[model samples]
Target: MEPLMDRVLREWRGKRVAITIGSEHSFTGILEDFDGEVLLLRNVVDVVGNRGKAMIVALEDVSWIMLLE
Candidate 1:
């Protein structure tokens, strides 16, 4: 199977995505870019609490992705 990043890269652009990171934090945003080591996400909203706005995340920090329709 292709790597997780490859799978993410294939379908993430311009789409709304939910990302799980660490153990309790999650982010919902417009998929922006991933440059090997980091993921640049736009229009981000925190799922846990009211932490509105943009967010940039390191790839290693992500656990999984839930693609939004």
Candidate 2:
């Protein structure tokens, strides 16, 4: 299997992905770009419905990633 980050980088583009951070925050969005260390996400919205048009999150901060079909 590919490294998780590499797999994430390869398979996530233009797809909806769910990211879990810490213990309480999770967001779903279209994967935009990753510059090796940070991820750019678009059309993001939290589980509770707070919308984020775009977001940049540090790669190290992510706990899990789920690719959506």
Best prediction by lDDT: 2
TM-score of candidate 1 on Cα atoms, chains taken together = 0.79
CA lDDT of every candidate: 0.80, 0.87
**Who wins the TM-score comparison?**
2
- Which 10-residue window in model 2 sums to the lowest lDDT? 1-10
- Model 1 per-residue lDDT tens digits across residues 1-69: 878777767677778898889867888888877777887778888875665567788889899877896
Candidate 2 per-residue C-alpha lDDT over 1-69 given as tens digits, one digit per residue, 9 for 90 to 100: 668777767777989999988757999999998877888889999999999899999888899888886
Candidate 2 residue spans exceeding 4 A from truth: 1-4
Q: Using Cα atoms with residue i matched to residue i, what is each candidate's TM-score against the true structure?
A: 0.79, 0.86
Residue 29 Cα positional deviation in candidate 1, in Å, after optimal superposition: 0.3
